[model samples]
Target: MSVVSDTIDWFSDSTHWSGDDGVPHRLVQHLGYTSLTIAIAAAVAIPIGLWIGHTGRLRGLAVVSSGALRALPTLGVLTYASLYTGIGIKAAIFTLVLLAIPPLLAGAYAGLESVDRQTIDAARSIGMTEWQILTKVEVPLALPLIVGGFRSSTLQVVATATVAAYIPGPGGLGRYLIDGLALRDYPQVVAGSVVVIVLALVLDGIFVLLQRLALRNRPAPVRSTV
Candidate 1:
């Protein structure tokens, strides 16, 4: 109860809402980090995944590799990268990119593989080239799962970005949590946690909408009238 009361007080304080170190600024910083890292991971991972899926070669390798990558500890990578890169947003971004890649890769390949073989054969029978079959058939169908993977990756990255505050530079909302802990300001720490949770929920909602839109735009199946 005391912690809740302190959190409310911390939020009520106007000073916490305004300044370079305020919630809004930190939120933006966190979003920037997340967006860039995910973008890079997507660019690198999706194409490779798609290619592997389309070719039907080395797919087991891709899956196993993604699983291994996902098992990596984010903080350990962050710490190691910071040691070599000397602690900054760059190192944090690098660590996050590594963390973000596996899901995106897995999603892409899974989405591609999930497409029905009959559909691919139908496309081929219709004189559709390999590229057309992929773009027009497989990709469209796989979109939901692909987006699901992206959503998962985004959520993970957003949560992890908070840890960037522990590095020696300006950080996101995690700053509030880290600083509050160092100073024993429990209220501030709680407030920071609430903010992070809210951000994750909001981002997740956006992705849900995106996934729905993708599904909604998907072409309806052709049915035969008896």
Candidate 2:
């Protein structure tokens, strides 16, 4: 097909692989956006989720808020934020962080909650402090789920970071989509999409390995004779 051949030609072009507009540079920019978004979202959401799970307070609030956030249209939010913030990476990151929070928040609380209540009781019964029980028993058991949340958040951010190119600043594989559409160069668009897909897959594979690693060392469940 012409499309396939054109895409191949596009990739074979050395110009696309070098300079500021190159694939490697765009990928690094995309990664910077994703890393910053995840870091900020985790810092904000994980603590709140942990508190809700640990104290049994505010679970209702977390549910409602996370659901509301998940329902937001990401591009619409980015557009509004860009308008408010003057069109730059700040607006893009704010939108991406908001997009990433629900999963991270859900994962944190759900992970903590998934820990056997009996195990927590056992830890408490042994004269362990609340902090120690959370740190030693609950957190270790909950890590897999928490990491699952991070995995989900990371993928979502990587996909959405492409949209960041729409605002005239920030560069990522999305530039291929935006620029390709403008120039009607379908081959570049397809190439960009392929690269984004590959990046996401690679990141996901890494997380899968991390999940297995977390599971391997997870603490054994505690049984209580209530």
Candidate 3:
């Protein structure tokens, strides 16, 4: 009860809202970090994934790599990066990009693979080039899964970006939690956690809508008359 009350008090305080370290500033910082990291990860992973899926080659490599990437500890990566590269947004972004890649890669390849082989054959029969088949048929069919991968990557990055505060420089909402802990301010810690959760939920909701919209726009199935 005391913790909850303190959290409410912390949120209600106008001074906290006005400072440079305020929620709005931190939120923007966090989002910037997240967006940049996700964009880089998508750029790197999606192309490779799509190629592997389309060519039906190196799939085992993709599986092994995805698993290895997933098993890596983000904190450990950050710690090592800080040790070698020194603490700053660069090291943080590097670590976060690594963290964001696996799911995006998996989704891209899996979505492409999941497309009906018969459909591909039909497209080929109709004289569609490989590029045309991929762009017109496979890509549209696989959009939901691709967007799903983006959603997963976004959520993971948002949660992990909070850990950036531990890097000893400008940071996102994680600063609240880390600083609160250092100062023994439980209310601030709770508030920071709530903010991260709310942000994740909102991003997730938007991604969900995108996935549904992609699926909804897919062409309807053909009907056969007896």
Candidate 4:
């Protein structure tokens, strides 16, 4: 209870984002990195995942590729990007994107694969263009899995984005934790850790709400076998 009360107190002023006379916060920098991670992951993962799932033949490829990518050490990507890009948020984003891609791609592929084949046949019989069948029938049916992937990516990014703080150029809570640890300021380290956890849970809640609303609006997908 004291931690919650104190956390609220610390955030009462948004201007606390600037490292200043106060505790020297850098939350905004972390949020920026999280956003960059999500955006890049979404861009790369969603479409490729959808395509592979829809094809069915490529599900193997999608699974294998995503699994391999997921297995790759995030530190490797982070180190590569950080060294080549010369530090800062951009390099961090590159690392986060890699972290985010696997789940997103797998989810999208899974969702699409779950789609009813009969509906697709019906769509094709009714003179729907291949693109139309894909966009309307396949994508809509796959929404749950796609959103699931998105949720996974969101969570992954939330945690991994903290690594950016290590790359320099004004990091988020990681920076705070590091600084606090360096100075032996236990309270500040605890505060920054609490902030990161809260941020991740909040982001997860928003995505869950979105997932429910989206499913609620969509008509139930026609059941079919692959």
Candidate 5:
């Protein structure tokens, strides 16, 4: 059992292999982080998106920015954030937050824009306060779209969290990927890849369920057929 043979054997037996300390622990830790990023992005994006949709200002900026963010690769943004923020989940979160902004903005804008002009006028005619119009009419009408945006953002964040391993800290499943690539361990690479993809799908599935619940609770929108 030469060194190469030993490493090859280790790679072949995944059950016996521990590629980078505690990879399972890292995966859990990164999952927590991905959750936080979703919260933060939603907090920041929802309001901005709401305001943009409600007031109808700087929508072009939101449109351009979110579209651009979508085109940007997770690795590219991770690299940029790592340069500024050092590494770890901070960079991952920052990158994800940017990724998150576009959908929220688009959803919020679309939601608010979807509000009927006549309904707005009607609300005004009855002496409904501006705040009332916003909280009651605008937000409620736009709720579905807003939730969809969040659901979309959550899925994106879940996937992007895997990239955080490139920064440092635990490494999540990505650490295996990074280490496996370096050591030429295909088993670890395949395993890590499988874990990340499966987890991403599972997380997105939960968000979809929640989104459906939200849609169900919202009032059926009123519209004139004429």
Candidate 6:
């Protein structure tokens, strides 16, 4: 109860709202990190995934690489990058982009693979070029899953962007955790955690809405009439 009260008090403190280190500033910093990470990861992963799926080549490589990437610890990667490249926002973004890639890659390839092969053949039969088949047929159909990838990647990036605080650079809500722990201010830590959780949930809800919107416009499966 005391901890809860302290957390509430921390929120009630107006001073926490206006400075460079305030919640709003930190939130923007976090968003910037997440946005950049996601953009880079998507750019790197999506095209490779698309090509692999379209060509039916390197499927094994994609699978192995995604698993390997997923298994790597973000902090370990950050530490290594910081040591080799020097601690800064670049190292932090690089770590997060790595973290974001696996899912986006998986999402792209898996979404493409989910398309019925016969559909592609039919498009081919209709004289649609390979690019047209992909852009018009495969991509639109795969949007829900692709958005799902973005959804997963965004959540992961948001949660992990806090690690930037440890890199001696801009931080998100994680600053609260790091600063609070160092000062033995558990309430601030709790408050920071609460904010991150809320941010994650809000982002998740937006993705869910996007998924629904995607599904609503998706073409329905054809059925044969007896």
Sort every candidate by lDDT, greatest first: 2, 3, 6, 1, 4, 5
Q: Candidate 5: misplaced stretches above 4 Å?
A: 1-24, 217-226
Alpha-carbon RMSD, each predicted model: 4.5, 3.8, 4.6, 4.0, 5.6, 4.1
- Over 138-159, each residue of candidate 6 has an lDDT whose tens digit, in order, gives 9888778888889999999998
What lDDT tens digits, residue by residue, belong to model 1 across residues 1-226?
A: 8999889988899998888878898899889889999999999999998898788889889878877888988878888888888967888999889888888888888888878899999999989999999899998888887888899999999998888778777488889888989999889999999999999999999988988887796665421100
Candidate 2's C-alpha runs over 4 A off are: 218-226
> Could you tally the backbone clashes for each prediction?
0, 0, 0, 0, 0, 0
Among these predictions, the greatest lDDT belongs to: 2
Cα lDDT of candidate 4 equals 0.74
Residue 67 of candidate 5: its Cα lDDT? Answer: 81
lDDT of each: 0.86, 0.89, 0.88, 0.74, 0.73, 0.86
Per-residue CA lDDT of candidate 4, range 149-185, in tens? 7887878787776665666764776776777677876
Worst 10 residues of 1 by lDDT: 217-226
> Residue 192's C-alpha lDDT in candidate 1?
95
TM-score of 5: 0.79
Scanning candidate 5 in windows of ten residues, the lowest lDDT window is: 217-226
Question: How do the residues 89-166 of candidate 3 rate in per-residue lDDT, one tens digit apiece?
Answer: 888999899999998998888888878899999999999999998899988888888888898999999999888778
lDDT of 2 by residue, 29-51 (tens): 88988999999999999999888
Give the per-residue Cα lDDT of candidate 5 at 40. Answer: 86
Clashing pairs in 5: none
- For residue 193, model 1's alpha carbon misses the true position, in angstroms, by 0.6
Q: Model 1 clash pairs?
A: none
Between prediction 3 and prediction 4, which has the larger lDDT? 3
Count of backbone collisions within predicted model 3: 0
Q: Write the per-residue lDDT of candidate 5 for residues 70-99, one digit (tens) a residue.
A: 899888888887898775557777877888
How displaced is residue 74 in candidate 1, in Å?
1.0
Model 1 spans > 4 angstroms off? 217-226
